[model samples]
Target chain A: MSTCKTAIRISAKAPRITILPLIQRRHESSARRHKKLLHLPQAPSYAPDRSAPSLIFNPPSSSPNVYHTPLKFLPKDDKRRTLYQTALNLSTHAALRRSTSAIATSGTPLTTSSHLPPRPSATLPPPVRAPYEKKYHLADKEIEEIRRLRLSDPDKWTRARLAEKFGCSQFFVGLVVKSHEKAERVEAEHERMRTRWGARRRAAREDRSRRKEMWGRDE
Target chain B: MKRIRIARCGTQLLAPPSPRRPLCPHVVRFQKTITLHNYRIQSRLQSTAAAREASNFEIESIVEEVESSANDFPSSTWTSPRHTPLELLPSPHPSAALKSAKLAALRSRLSLPPRFPLQTLARTLIHPSADPDPTFNNGSLSILGANLLGYYTTEHILCNYPRLPMSVVFAAQWAYIGPKALATVASEWGIEAAAEPGGEIDPGLLQFKRLRSGDDLPTLLKGKQAPWKWNVTMTNKILKSDEFGSTASRPDAQQLQGMPVPIEEAAQSFVRALIGSLYLHLGRPLTKRFFRDHFLSRHLDMDKLFDFRTPTRDLSRLCAREGFEAPVARLISETGRHSNHPVFIVGVYSGKDKLGEGAGSSLNEARIRAAAAALKAWYLYKPLEVTVPSSTEGEVDTSKWKPNMVDCGEVIV
Candidate 1:
């Protein structure tokens, strides 16, 4: 990489010297292609002659210039053949389009296991616990007492403070001490805090949008 | 090297101070009398005081000569035919269009029939900024053409993809025949503007007064810009705005007469004029064919126009509206969860039927992708058999006409 950088830096000084670095970059791309091929453990090694100017090789695992991959390597009775073919078919023009990411599906559960490689269950590592889990459970009366204290001094007794006192997660404290009036009041107080700097922030945002619309270049 | 003395540039309005020894003797010369074509025009200007006032821009000595000439022999000009100088005319004479090879070539290039007169084509090239006269300018034709273009584009979008959201439909319309798009189409058609508009220029070239560089744009072009609080409703946009659903008020074409306009505006006006003239001469059938060949043939990806804020919620709402089961996004497959690079494939299902599938680097991303895919599928539904309403016009047989499925518009949030 340092040699490539040096070659590029020196090549700018003399126009004729750019050819060597150009060849070197092509060699690097070819080397990357080889490394990518190496990742497929099931495929045979495709090491080509280094002295040659170019190497032309296509792996047997996949076909070139076509939509569908070659299924010749799969055994006759393999269950994954149909699934793989279906996936390939679905990716083509006729099938459903690949949708973009959006806000609504931001917190969806991840549990799909169909196409995943089957690994030994014993070999897999144990799952980790959530960061905000309570160390000990609270009794019904204790929960009631915490809720009462939270509602009595809504501004003073914040979710964090109540959670710390009860030795429970802030999420659990939130559920226990929920009151519409208290929530609205706290929200109003938060808004009041932000209102002091709101004008400046809004001006900055408007200026940014205006600049972007006019010139298209970022300042 | 010898130092060169460059003369300072000055306009007629601000004549430079008289030099001690004039480099050019004409700079300090006495005003010459006008004997050329001034006699005929001077007598004609006598009737209208406003025209006489406008002629004040002429040399002071020439105006004196015209006044003397008008009093001396007003009968001689009235007896003979009037002769208006070519340079005095705002635009080329209609007869000049017949002689221009460029005009003929342009006509054949567009494959317009010989019946479509070159005079009308020449008239189309003359923007109101170039020639303010209603007969010579393209203002009225452009208005007609703009309405026709809007009608055709709106119907095509609505009848084809009836389920498209209002915003997406507006975007699609803009993409198809907006000012920028029309300008692009005009340039592609080999339309070239003259250096400046005058009677001496070829009729084939587009004629419009060029906007001066760095000048503050006219009020009409600087549309009414409202702040975010204005709350420009979609209903108001549809009812009040231009075909593109823009909230800003467009400049009136008539008001832009004799004023300098941007090249894009001139080019767009030319395209609209061409369509308007074609509709008048060739009738509706040929105009439809021309529209299909030119505008409709351009490639615009409808699916890429969507920018969903919440795809999952929109999809669920769509399913609910259509009386389908509520959509459920289930992870179909995943790999490398603990590693830096994880792949998750998700499928959105409404009951047993899988609506759409997608894959991403994270579970949430995959789910979002799946939901968006399902929503797109619902929006992009096209019936196998379709017939546009325009196709049925003037047809003797209506047997082949099938009623197009009009899906209720996209789910609004």
Candidate 2:
């Protein structure tokens, strides 16, 4: 038989239905994962696997996109992948609290939940319809704070605490934190640059001596 | 202008009606059909870009005719062959304006590197009859069971290449294809290949790069994460190259055994195999380590290296440790060439220290020379009567043997 037809018509006569609904579906899934962030640390008790002979820790699952922040630091090794996921989970919790508190501190206790007490209008920040973005956007310094709490914390911040502090759903906070080799490399590079800067004063003196000697010889 | 620019920036939000056509020409011809197609396309694109808030399709694709028409003219939204306007559904979203902004920002932040290209071995397999490698009996592995010298040798060869599993190139060649196929190959044998490469090597691998540094546990172990514990703390501690010249030495010294062939002369095939596996792993040919005339050359005959076990002895225990079986441990023990073990070279047990022993590199080399000394011991201590006490008078007194040149043919197997 001859080869099958090469030209496959991708879109029907109508394209919008195919496009917009798909995006909406994806955002809804992301929102599901984001909403779950609030429940992570105290998330329903450890349900044992009936089939397993022993207690095995199940990897906490999230929307696959949750790893976007954490996996960047790890190599391809599985242990690294797990470590990265753990770190991301930690940060996601912290980031949620951070984001919420910042929004709250600005006097907008924008708790979408009806269960939360009504805020005093006098204490509230101006209700600017910042389109859910400017209010949620992470600042560079705040990003640094979240990163430090996740990476350098002695007790290793738990998922719940992170969520509570960052004002995010605990699950979203968990996603915001992660560890990686690339991060290590970045840290190393930063140190190297700092060391170079530290040596500049000594080099300047040595250069001055050489220049003076050259001037004397010319005279 | 602002609306057009927003649409332009979020190009992926709509698939541009082929660059061949004006914006949404199909809308006029079949308006309802076009609208249906746009919604379907968005879901497909969303699946791939689920992880990212905004992907290339969301940012760069052109607006589909149906969605655009609906958004632009909400009054004329539906057509079920009867021109009744569909109720304006809540623009199904966090709103298009928010999406457009997120897509634009995420697009700027995105960057990904290109992956490694396929190499010669891959290219050869894809195009049959590409090289001298005979396809005949390409799969048959006869009689060779556990502890077979040939099997170990082939494994040791591939161990030199860091990432390649032996089965990847040999057993179910599909291993190089991907993780799923590789997992299948491993499961068939009831062996789950480690998620990460064990990253160890053959004992003879003097040139391997240590990914980390280790000041302790001896440089031979090279701080490799043990397949057992996989402790990350023990990273890349390598031995200095200069020290390699002093420590690596040959096993035997005295006389060549068997056909009196040079050890190096016999080891050509082994060396070829070694180089071939290295070529496969490193993506580069083994040149510097192969052609060296240094101490390594002076000690072990790369030629006599007919088995993998020979190199396995000099190399560290960690080197032989592949994913599952530690094959080198068995091969090293079976050779029976160490002085501690006895072999076929018959000689009296007179223990005179041999010459090569003094110049040998490791104790393995010293022991090898001691065995050769055993060969000479048999001749030197041959006890006999002083005057040839032959019971039969007719027997010629030729019983007393005379001296001949002391020679033990090449010792390689």
TM values, all candidates: 0.60, 0.14
Clashing pairs in 1: A112-B331
Question: Residue B67 deviation, candidate 2, in Å?
Answer: 15
- Candidate models: Cα lDDT each: 0.68, 0.29
Query: Which 10-residue window in model 1 chain B sums to the lowest lDDT?
Result: B7-16
User: Lowest lDDT 10-mer window, candidate 1 chain A?
Assistant: A61-70
lDDT of 2 at B51: 38
RMSD of each: 19.6, 46.6
Question: Considering summed lDDT, which 10 consecutive residues are worst modelled in model 2 chain B?
Answer: B137-146
Candidate 2 residue lDDT tens string, B178-244 = 2233233223323211111111211111111123333232332222233655432211211321101
Residue B366 in model 2: lDDT: 30
| Per-residue accuracy of model 1 over B1-413 as CA lDDT, tens digit each | 65332222111101212223323323223112323324323333332222534354333344344344434432333322135555556777666899999899999999998978887889889999988766568888898899899999998988877667788889999999999999999999999999898878899999999998898787788888879799998888889888889977767678898889889999999999889888877778999999999999999977677666678788778778777777777766679999999987776766555666666666766766767767766666554455888889878899989887676567976
The TM-score, computed over Cα atoms with residue i paired to residue i, of candidate 2 is 0.14
> Whole-model lDDT, candidate 2?
0.29
